[model samples]
Target: MTEFALDAPVLVRPYTARRDGDFAVIGDDSRQVYLSIPAEGLDLLEWLRDGATVGEAVRRFEATHAASPDADAFLQALADEGFLAPAGAHDPPPDAEPARARRAGHLEWLSPHAARRLLSRPVLAVCGVVVGVAVAMAVDRPGLVPGPSSLMFHSHFWAYLLVVLGIAVIGVWLHELAHVVGARAAGTSARMTVGNQMYAIVAQTDLSGMWMASKRERFVAVLVGPLVDVIGAALLFITLWLNDVGVLGLPEPVRLVVAGVLFTSFIRLLWQTFLFLRTDFYYLITTALDTRSLMADTGAFLRNLVRRVLRRRLIDQSGVGRGEMRTIRIYAVVWVLGRVVALAVLFTATIPLLWFYLVRVVGFFRGDEMTGQFTWADVLALAMLSFLLDGGGTLMWLRSLRRSSRLRRRAPDRVLVE
Candidate 1:
C-alpha cells in the first residue's frame, strides 16, 4: 500500500448511520465493520465522503465546533478501523478479511417478537420469584447446597457419570439458547459451539455482532445466560423440596439425577465469575468499560509497570486513554489476583484429582483387584471421567492456541471503541 498525500481526497466506506447517545454509529448489516464515534466524527466522515481532503475536514471540524480535533489520532483511528483509506484504494488487502465463524443458527423459529415475549417482564418476574423462594429454602436446608461430593449419588459410578454428562450437555444448549434469545431481542443473532477456556472445556456463544447494539441489549444478551441458569437451578431445587415434603413422590434415582443437573448448573454459574478466564462477565466488563483491546492493554500495563520499577524500557499502551488506563490499572490487580488463585487451585486441587485417578487406574492394571468399596465399575468410570476432562481439556486448550494464531492472522472481531 502506497502512502498518499494528506491533501489527496479520502475515501469513507458507505455505512448506515444511527444516533447512540453522544456517539454516532456507522455500520453495515453485512458485518463489514461498525464504528462508534463522537458526534462530530460523523461530520468528519461526511466531509471526507464529499471529496474533502483530511486537511480540509480537520479545518472544517475546528471551524464548526470552535475546537480543534486530534487530526492525526482521528485519521489513524479511522484508517485502522477500516473506515478510511488512501486515494483510489478501492479494494481491501486479500489478507485483511473479516474472520467468519460457522453459525449453527439454532432456534430459527424464535423470531425477535417471540424472543421479546419470552423475555417479557411477566416472565422475568415469575423467574425471579421462583429463584428467590428457592434461595430462601436452600438457606434453611443445608442439604440443598451442592458440593464436589454431590456429583455421585447413585450406587453405580457409570450411572452417575452418564446422567451428569447428559445434564451438562442439555445445560450448555439452554445456556447458549438464552444468549441467542437475547441477541434476537436485540435485533440480531449469534451461534454456539463447543469451545474451551484457557484450561477448561466450555460452550461458547458468538455474540460478536452484539457489539453494534445498545449497551442495554448487550447487557441483556451477555447476562441472560447466567440468569437462565439460576432459574433452571431454582426449578430443580423446588422440585426436590416438593419430593422431600411428600407433595411429590419422585423416586430416588430420578431425584438424584435432578440433583446432578443442579450441581452442574451451580458449577456453570461459578465458572462465569472467573472474568479473567474469557467468560461472559469478561465480555460485559469490556463492553461497559468501552475497551477495544482490554486483554492486550492489561498486558501492556503490567509490562510497563515492571519496566518502570526495573528502570528498563517501557512499552506503549497502544492508544488507551488515561481514564481507561486508570481503570485498567485497577483491573490489572483483579486479573493478577484471579490468576494467582487459579494457579493455587490447579496446584492444590486439580493436580491432586488428576494424580488420584491416575494412580488408582495404575494400581488396578498391576494385578490389583478392585477391593473394598471401589468396584471395577467405579475404577472405569472415574478413570474415563478424569481422563476426558483433565486430559482432553488440556488437549483442547493446546488446540485453542492454533485458533488464536488464526485469529491474529485475520481481521479482528471488532469490539466497541470510544
Candidate 2:
C-alpha cells in the first residue's frame, strides 16, 4: 500500500457524474466502470478533480462535516483503479469506445441526424396510431399468433435454416437499431456492437450516457427495444391476418415465412421478459425505481442472509444506500425464484426435447427404424437441434466457467459481488 503524501497533488480522472435520488452515479469510461457514492463522497471527489492536495481535501472534509474522512484508503483505492492521477497528467484514454460506428445493413445510409428526424413527433404519432390499430386487429384473430405446430411444420431443411437464421439476423439488427434510435430521441448518443451476452453472441446498444439523461429519457431508451419487438410482432400478426382473409394475395411459401417471422418475434418478446437475465425489462425497472445497483445489492443481501444463517462473518449491509434496500430485497427473492424455475423448465422441457431429437437422429442412422418415415432432412434438423441445445450450450457454459475460474485465480484477494 502506497502512503499518501500530504503535499502531493492528486486529481480524479475524467468521469461523468449524475444524480440518482440521494446518490451520485459516477461513470469512469476509461475503465468501463460505474460507481455510486453518497453526496459526501461526491463532494470529496469533486474537490479532488479540482486538484486538491490530500491534506487540503481532508481539512475541507473535516471542516464541512466536523469529522475527518478516511481519505487514505479511499484515495488509495481510486489510485489503484487508475481513477486518480498526478495533477499534471494528461487525460486518461478510455479502454473502449462506447459509441462505435458500423454499417447497419440497409439502415447504413441513415445518418444519426436523419434517424433523429425520422423518429420525430409526427412520425411517432403515426407509429403510435399504426401500432394501436394493429394491436386491436390482432386481438380477435388468434391464428395471427403462431403455435407449436406451425413452428414444427415439416419444411425443406434448407428452407427452415434460411428462414430462422434470416429472421433472427434481421430481427436482432432492428432490435439494436431501435435502442440507438431511442437514445438519440432522448437527446443522447448511443452505439451498437456485437458481444457475448450470457451464452450467445448478440447485438448490444451502449447507452451508458443514459445515466446523465432524465428518468423519462432513460425509460424511453430502455423501453424501445421491447417496444420494437412488440410492434414487430403486432405488424406480423396484421400481415398474417391479411393473408388469412385473402386481402393480400400471397404465395404459400411467403405465408409460411411470415408465420416464421411472427414466431421469432414472439420468442424475442418472451426472452425480453426474463428480468433475471438483466434483459431490457431489467433496466426499465431499475431505472424507473432509481435503483443504481439492483443486481449487486441483491447479491450482497443474499450472501449476508446466508452468512447470518451459518453464524459466520457477514459483510455489512449498512453501506448500501437507503433507496436501494427495498428494491434489492424484492429483487433477490425474484432472482432466486426465477433461477429455480428456469432450471426446472430446462430439465422438464428443454432436456427432453434435446434427448428426443438426439435419439431420432441416432434412429435415422440405424437400420432398425428403416429410415422410411424419417428422411435425411429430419435427421439433419434433429442433429442441428441437438448440437445447439446440448453441444453448443454446454461449450459456452464451460468457456464462461473457465474464464471466471481464471479471473478468480488471478485476483484471489478480490471479492465478487455476485
Candidate 3:
C-alpha cells in the first residue's frame, strides 16, 4: 500500500457517485473505474469530497456510525481505482477527465437521439412483426431451416465461400454495431473490436461505459446486439422461402448461397447460448442481476477454493458484494459444468476431425497406400482449417492477452466490478 499523510486533505478525481439499491456506485467513465460499495464507503467518499483527511474522515464516521472505517484501507481502495488526486489540491487534478475510449470514430454521427429512434419501441415492434411473419412461414414450409444436406455446395465451392463469408462478415459487423448503438442510446460510449473467444475469432464491443447508465438502459445496451442479430437472420430465412416457391425462381447456386447463410446464422445463434463463454446473453444476465463482473468473480471463487484445498495463500474476494457473491457461488457451478460440456465436445469432435485430416496428409507425403480416397482439394481444405485453428487462434489469443494487459495496467480487474 502507498503511504499517505494522515493530516493532509485528500482530493478525489472527477467521479459520478450514485446510490443503487443498498450500495453506492462510483466511477470515472473515461477511465473505466466503476465499483459498488457499502454505505460507509459512500460516506467516506463524501467526507473526502468535503476536504476531509483520511484520519479525520475515519474519526467522523466512527463518531456517528456503529462501524469503524479503516483509514489505510480506505485510501488504498480509492488509489486502487485511480480515484485520488494530490493531497491538499485546491482543484480537482488536471487529469481528472481522461480521454474517452478508443471507439469507432466513424460512429460519431450516431448520436443518442438517433440510437434511441433506431431502437425505439415502434421500430422494435415492426421488427417483431417481421420476425413473426418469418416464423409463420417457416412453420408452413418447414424446409426453411437448413440441415446437413443444405451445406453441400461442392461444385459451387468458390461462390459458396465468397457469398457465405461476405454475409458472415457483414453479420458480425451488424451484430457489434447493435451493441454500439445500444450504448449510444444510453448516452454512453462504446468501442468495437476483433477479439477471440478461446480459439475462434469474435467481434466484440466494449460497453463498459454503460456502468454509468441506469439498469434499464444497461439492459438495452447488452440485449440489442443479440436481438437485432436474430431478427436479421429471420429476415434472411424469409427471403430464401420467398425464392423457393417460383416467385423469384432463383438459380440453384444462388439458393445454395442463401442456404449457407441460414446454416451459419443458426449455428451462430446457438453458439451464443454457451453462457460459459460469456456471450452477449451473459452480459444481459449480469445487467438483470445487477452483479459486478460475475464471470470474473466466479472464476476467482473457483481459483481460491482450489488454493484453499491446497493450503495455499488464497486471494481475497471480500470486496465482492454479498448478493453478488451468492450469485457467483451458484454461477461457479454453472461455469464448471459449461466448461466440461465444451471440453467434451472439443475432444469428441475436434480430435476426430484432426486425426482424420492429419493421417491422410501424412500418408500423401510418405507415398504410402491410401486407405480412404484423398484429393488435393481435401488437402487444401485441411491446410486452411489447420492454419485457422492453430496459427490464427494462437495469434488471436496473444492479441487478446496484450489488449487486457494494456487496458488493465493501472489496476486489477477487481477495480471495475464491486
Candidate 4:
C-alpha cells in the first residue's frame, strides 16, 4: 500500500464526491483545518493527527478496529484526497497560523430561495418585461426621435458610471430571474453568486444534482434566459413600431431607455449563446452530450495527449475516466473539423470587411487637406498600425491553432442520451 506524509498545513478541499462517506477537508479562519471523515475513518484520522506516521496510524487502526480490512489502502486513499499532509510540513508557522485557519464556509445556499420565489411564473416574467420596458419608455422618450441629452454630469465619473451601472444591474438581475423561473417550472434549484469581478454578478443552477433528469427539463432551464431576451426584444420592436405609426407618443428620454435596454438584452442573449465562452450554451452542449464530467475529463486527456505528442512527461491522468477518454477521442476529430470550417468562414467574412475598412481609412488620410479633418499621413499611419495589430493578433492565434486543434480533439459531444 502507498503511504504519504501529511507535512503541509494547507490541504485541498474536496468539492465534489462520487460516493457517500467521503471526507471533506475544510480550512478554518485560524489556520486550522478540519477533516470531516466518515465515522469509520475517524479513529485512523485522529491517530495520524496525533503525530502518528502512516504505519503507526495503520497499526492503531488495526488494534482499534480488528474487523476492518485493507487499512493500508484506506490510509493511501486518505492521503490522495489530501486529508493528511506529509508529517514534517503539516505545521503552520505560529505567526501565520491564524490567518491560514480562518476560512469562510461555503455559502452555496445563499440566494437560492429568494431566486426561486422571484422567478416562479411565466406570467410574472412577462409582466416584469412589460413593466421594465414601460418604465424605460416612460422615463426616457416619447418616440424614436433623438431626444435631448440625458447624460448626467457629476464631479466624479465613477458616480455617473455607477448610475448607469445601477440600470445594468437591474437588467442582469431580471435575466437571472428568468433562469430561476425556468428552473422552478422544471422543479430544479438554482443559486446565484458573483462570478467574475468584471460584472460582479452570476447565477448558477445546482443542476449537477439533476443530471439524471430528462433532457426536456434541462433544455427548458437552459433556454429560459434566451426566451426572456426574445420577449424583451419583441416588446422593444412593438414599442418602436407603435411610435413610428403614431399610435402613442414616447418621450425622447423614454425612447433612449427602451432602446438601450433592448440592445443590452439582445447582447446578453448573444453572449449566452456562444458555446465556446462556457456560458449557458456550454451547459446545454454538455447536457446534450450526456457526459456530465466532459469538460474536466476531456481537458485532462487532451493535456496528456499534448504532452505525449510533444515528448513531455505526463502529469495527472487520474481525472480522465475510461468513458471520458473515449469521448475525448471522438471530440478531438470533430473539434479539428469544426475549427477548419470556422477558420475558412472567418477568413471569407472578416477579410473583406477588414480590407474595406482599410481602404476607407487610407482614403480619409490621403484626401485633400482642405476637405479633410486630419492629414493623409496621420490617417495612413494610424490605419497601417491598426492593420499591423490586427494582422499580428490573427497570426498569433493562427500559430496557436495547432495547440487548440489538439485540445479540441476532445471537445464535448453535441448530443446526449437519457
Please tell me which predicted candidate would have the highest TM-score against the true structure. 3
Candidate 1 Cα errors over 4 Å, as ranges: 16-39, 67-77, 94-98, 101-105, 139-142, 286-293, 309-315, 318-322, 355-368, 399-418
Candidate 3 per-residue lDDT, tens place, 278-380, comes to 7888877887887867877786788678877988766578777787888988888888998787667656776576676677777677886644343455565
**Deviating ranges (above 4 Å) for candidate 4:** 1-3, 6-84, 88-112, 122-228, 240-246, 249-277, 287-293, 299-330, 345-418
How many pairs collide in each candidate, listed in order? 0, 0, 0, 43
Candidate 3 Cα errors over 4 Å, as ranges: 85-106, 351-382, 398-418
Per-residue CA lDDT of candidate 2, range 212-282, in tens? 67788788778778777877877877888887888998898777778877787777888878877777988
Q: Model 3 scores what on Cα lDDT?
A: 0.74
Candidate 4, 1-418: lDDT as tens digits: 2336433232322222221223322323132333233444666655656566656766666687685546555555455434444445454332221222233322334354554455557656765777577556645654442222333322333333344445656767666666655555544445444332111124443343333235666776676666666666667756875776689799955655555556556567766754433468777777676555455455556566777898866655443447656776776665556556656755785565568558777556576332434434444544554455445546655655554565444432211111
Question: CA lDDT, every prediction?
Answer: 0.76, 0.70, 0.74, 0.51
What TM-score against the true fold does each predicted structure earn?
0.83, 0.83, 0.85, 0.45
Return the TM-score for candidate 4, rounded to 2 decimals. Answer: 0.45
The local distance difference test score of model 4 is 0.51
User: Candidate 3, after superposition: displacement of residue 80 in Å?
Assistant: 2.4
Best by lDDT, which number? 1
> lDDT (0-100) at residue 236 of candidate 3?
81
Better of 3 and 4 by TM-score: 3
- Candidate 2 positional error at 261, Å: 1.5
